[model samples]
Target chain A: MHEASAATAPGRGGRDLAISVRDLVVGFGDTLVVRGLDLDVYRGEVLGFVGGSGTGKSVLTRTILGLERKRSGRIEVFGEDLDKASAADHARIERRMGVMFQQGALFSNLTVKQNIQVPMREHLRLSPRFADELAMLKLALVGLDLDAADKLPAQLSGGMIKRAALARALALDPELVFLDEPTSGLDPIGAADFDELIATLQKTLGLTVFMVTHDLDSIYAICDRVAALAEGKVIAAGPISTLLASDHPWVHAYFHGTRARRFQDVQ
Target chain B: MEIPDGPTFKSSRSRDAITFELAGRWTIGASAALEDGARAVFAEASKVRRAVLDLGAVAALDTAGAWLIDKTRRELAAAGVEARLERVRPEYGILLEEAHYRQFEAPSGKRRLYAAVLLADIGESVVSFGKDVLAGVSFLGEVVASLLGTIIAPLRFRAISLVFHIEQIGFRSVPIIGLINFLVGCIVAQQGIFQLQRFGASTFAVDLIGILVLRELGVLLTSIMIAGRSGSAVTAEIGSMKMREEIDALKVMGLRPVEVLIVPRILALVISLPLLTFIADMAALFGGLLVAWGYGGINPAAFMARLQSAIGENTFLVGIIKAPFMALVIGIIASMEGLAVAGSAESLGRRVTASVVKSIFMVIVLDGFFAVFFAGIRY
Candidate 1:
C-alpha cells in the first residue's frame, strides 16, 4: 500500500491509491492554508486526518473535493486527474465519492429518507420499491431508526443528524467517503457508538474513508493510519505508535497534550 | 477502467437439482440487471428440490447488489426449496449480512374525506384567529410593561438604539414615500379635473385633491408602504437574531429582550410615522398644486387659495393622529412574529411573510375604523 508519509510508512507499490495529492497549495487571498501538501489514501483503509483548530484540515478536503480552488497542485481520485477530467468524467468520478459536512448539511426542507434518496435519484434509475428499500437499508446501516426516515433534519438531534448525514453520504454506496468532524458534537457514549458504526461500515463495505476529526478516540478506534497536519503540510503520517514516537514539537504536543494523555494509558 | 458489465445468472437443471451461477458486476449502477438476475434465479429455483447459487464469478458487489441476492436466497428457502450461497468472498459475505432484507413499515394510509378536511381547516383558522387576538393583546401588555419600566428608569432606556432605528425606518424611507405620494396626488387631481370639467367646474378638482391628500390618501399610502418595507425588515431581523439564540443570550445577560430590542424599534416606528405622514402630506399638496396649474388651467396661486378653504385644520390632524396607532399595530405585529421564530430558517421566512401581510391588513382595517370614528365626531 502507498502510505502517505515517505519516511515511516511501508510502501507496497501495486496497491491502488484512492486519493493522491502532490504539491497541493490552497489559500484564501494571501493566507495559504495547505502549502505543498503531499498525501495518499490507499483503497479500503480509513485515514484519520488531524490538525490544530485553524490548520485547515477541512480546506484540504474541500480542495480535493473541488469545492475549493487550489492555487497549484495535482489531485487524483481513482487514478483520474481531477483538473484534466472532462465534465462527464468529473461527474462519474464524483458519483464514486461521498461527503458529510461538519454541520450535517442535510437539506433542511427534505425528510431524512428523501435526503438519502437524493443522490440515487440524481444519478441512477430505480423503481420506487428498490429506491425505498435502498434508502431504508442506508438508514439501517447508519443505525438510525426507521421512523427518522420521515422527519426533517430540524427535528433530529445532534447524533441523529450525524447518522442521517452519514446515511445520505452513503446513499450511492460510494467507494470513498469524506467525513468532516464526524463525531464532534456527540456525547461520549454517542461518540463511541458512532466510532463503532464507522468501523463496522468501513470493514463491511471495504470503503476508503478520509475522516477529518479532532476526536482522539475516533482516531484510535477506527483509523488504520493517522496523518497530522502542521505548517500547512503533513508533518507526520503513520500509526499512533509512530505519532507518539515523533520528536516534532507539534506532533509531540498533540498526542501528549493534557487532553490526549488520557488515551496514552488506554493504549 | 469503466466496467459497465451487467449482472447475469446461468442456470442449469439436472433432474430436480438446479445450479445457478451469477456473474458480472452486481452493483446499483446495473440496477435493471440486478433485478433481472434475481427474477431469473427465483423463477428457476422454485421448481427444483435443491438449488445452489454461486457468486464465485461475480465481478463486483455493493449493499444494493448484495440485498437482491440475499433476499432471493431467503425467499427461495421460504418456498420449501433449500438454497444456499456458494463461494461467497469474505467482503461480499459481510456485505450480504449487512444488507439483509426485512419488512419496512410503510407510511400510514387513508387521509380524511375532502369535505370534512376543508371544514376542519376552516374551523381551525377561525379558532386560530381568536387565539391571534389574545396573543396580540398579551404581547401588547408585555410591551407596555417594558415601556413603563423604561419610563420609570430613564437610565435603562436605549437612546442610541432608538436613534439608529429611527434613522433606519424613518429617514431612509422618505424618498420613496415622497415619490409615490407625489405621483398619486397628480393622478387624483388629473382624474378629478377630467370628470368635473363636464359640469364646467374644472377648478373643483383642487378641493378634491386638497381634502383627499390631507385626510386619507397620504397617511394610508405611507402606512402601507412602511408595513411592507420596515415591518418586514423588523420581522426578518429579529427573527434571525432569535434563530441564532441572540435573544436568549440577552436574557441570560440580565436584559429584557422586549425592552432592549422591541421597545426601541417600536418607539422609532411611533416617532417616525407621524413625521413621515407630514412629509407625505406636503409632497402630495406640492404635486397637486403643480398638476392643477399644468393640467386643469388652475394656476399655483389659485390652487393654494382654493386648497386653504377646501380643507380645515381637522383634515390634516385627522391623518396625522392615526399615524402612531398604525405604527403601533405594525410594530406589535412585526415584533410578535419575529419573536415567534423557531429553530428553522423556513420558520423565519414564514414569520417575515406573515408579519408584512398581517400588518398591512390591520393597518387598512384600523384606518376604516378611524374613518368611522372621525365621521361620527364630525371631524
Candidate 2:
C-alpha cells in the first residue's frame, strides 16, 4: 500500500494524478448529498468508491463527470481544472475519458455493434468498414459472442448488456474510465469475470478507473485503492487493509460485517 | 511515409484467371480511392473463373484493409470465382479471419411474397382483433364490477382521481371544441344559404344548420376530438406507467389498477363527453345564428325562431344520447391499449395510435347505429 502511494506521489509518473477533487460540495435543494469531499485518483489505478445505499457515491461521480451541478467545488481531470476549462478544452478532455453508467444506459434504439461504433464515429473519422471491424474486435474483447453484435440491447441478457456497455467505454481507448455499479446485477462468476477484464484492461491499456460499487468482492479482488463515502464525505481512503483497520464507525462496521466476513474468508 | 497515389490496383486477364497486384496503404485514410479501386477490381473479376490477389507489394494494412480484402473475397466467392490472397501480411491475418467468420450476409432468399402468405397475414390480423375485442370486453366487465363494488363501499372510491381526470379530459378541452364546432357551424350555414338562395328559399338555410348541428355534428365532432386529444393522452400516460412497472407496483400494494386508474378516467370521459356535446351544440347554433344574421341578411329574432321550430327537443337529445356511448368506447379502447403496452417505447407509441384510431372508428360506427335507431323510433 505504501509503495502504491509512493508511486502515485506528485513528482512521479508524468502526471500521476488523473483526477483531483477538492472541497467539493454538491446538493439538491436543501439536502446536501456530497459535502466537504476531497479525493484523488492516481493515474493507471483502479479506485473503488463504496458507500451505503443513497450515500451519494453515484451523485459524486456524476458531479465529477459534469452531469450534475455542484454547489461549490474544484474538480481537476488530467491537470486541467474542469470549472475553468473552455468548451473546446472540456470536450477534448471529455473525449479522453469514458463512462459506463449503471444499468448499461445503452441506447435502446441501436444494435450492440452500432452502440460501440457511435462514440468512435463521433470522435474519429473512419470508414464504416473500419468502424464495423473495430466494433467486432471490441465485442470480442468484452467476451461477448460475435453474433451478439447485431442484437439489440433489449435482446441481450443483463450480463451481455454490461459487457456491451464496457466495450463502448473502451472504444475510444480512453485514459480514464468511470464505471458505476458495473457488476451489480451479474452473478458471482460473471462479476468475477468482469472484474478480471477490468483489471486486465487497466494494466494493458493503462487506464485510470474510477468505479462506484457496493461489491466488496470486487473491491477486494481488483481495486488498487478503496474510498469509503459516508456522512457526506469520504471518511476513509486507502487500500483494503487500511479500511479494515480503520477506527471510523461506519467504515469498521462495513468492513467487519457478516457479508464482508464471508468475502474475507476466501481472500 | 504517405501513399501519394492512394491505394491502386492493376488487374490483367490471364488464360482463365485474373491476377491483381494490390499496393499502397489500403487503410481508412485512403478509403475513397481504395473503395473505388476495389469496385473496379470486383467488376473486372466477374469474367474470370479464378483470381489471384497479390499483396506482397502493399505498403501497409489494418482492419480497414483487411475488411476490404475479406469483402472482395466474399463478393468474388458469391459470383462463383475462387479468389485467393497471396503474401498476406501476418498482421492482417487475425482481422481477416475474424471478419471472414462473422459473415454479414443477411438471412437471404427466404422471403416469398405469396398470395397464401398475404391471406395468412390477413387471417392473423383478424384473429388478433378478435382477441383484442375479447380482452376489451372482459376488461369492461371487470371495471363495471369494481364500480359496483365502489358504489357499495363509497369509501373505496377514488374521488380525487376522478375529479383530476375530469379536469384533464373535460375542462382543458372546452375552448378548442367550442372553436372548431363554431367554425364548422358557420361553414354549414354559409353553404346552405349560398345553395338555397338559388331556389329563392334562403330562409330554409337555418333548418339545414339546426338539424345537422343538433342531431349529428355536435356529438360526432366532439367525440372525435375527445378521442383524438384526451383518449391518446390517457393511453400514453397509462402505457408509460405500465412500461415503468408502476402498474405491477400498484398490484403488489393490494390495489386494483383498473379501479384506481382506468375507472376514474373512463368515468370522467363518460361524464364529460355528454356535457361537452351539449356545449358544442349550443356553440354551433350560436355560430349559425351569427351567419344567418350577417350572410343571409336574416334578423337574429327570425333565425332564433327558425332554429327553435326546426330542431326539436328530441333532435338535441338524440345527439346527447350518443355522447356517453362514444365516451365509453374511447375510454375502454384507450385503457385497453394502455394496459396492453409491452416493455418498449415503440409498443407504447403503437398502442397510443391504435387507441385513438380504434376509438374514433368505433365512435363513428356507434353514431351510425344511433342514427338508425332514432329514425326507426320516429324521434
List chain A TM-scores, every candidate, in order: 0.96, 0.94
Model 2 B-chain TM: 0.85
Model 1: residue A43 alpha-carbon error in angstroms: 0.9
- Residue-level lDDT tens digits of model 1 in B1-379: 5677799878878888998888888998885667777888898898888999999999999999999988888899899999989999998989999999877889786789999999999999999989998999999999999999988999999999999999999999999999999999899988999999999999899889989988899999999999999999999999999999999999999999999999999999999999999999999888888888898989998888888889899999999999999999999999999999999999999999999999999999999999999999999
Model 2 root mean square deviation, Cα atoms = 7.0
What is the Å distance of residue B351 in model 2 from its true position? 2.2
Model 2, range A123-209, lDDT digits (tens) per residue? Answer: 766667657766886787678998888899989999999999999987766779999999999999999999998887776556799
- Give each model a TM-score: 0.95, 0.75
Instruction: Count steric clashes of candidate 1.
Output: 0
- In candidate 2, what are the lDDT values of residues B88-158, reduced to their tens digit? 76645654664353444332447767998999999999999899889888988998999999999999999
* lDDT tens per residue, model 1, A81-140: 899999999998899999999999999999999999999888888888889999999999
Off by over 4 Å in 2: A1-15, A23-37, A52-55, A69-74, A81-91, A125-127, A230-233, A263-267, B1-127, B141-168, B171-205, B244-246, B249-260, B290-299, B372-379
Best by lDDT: 1
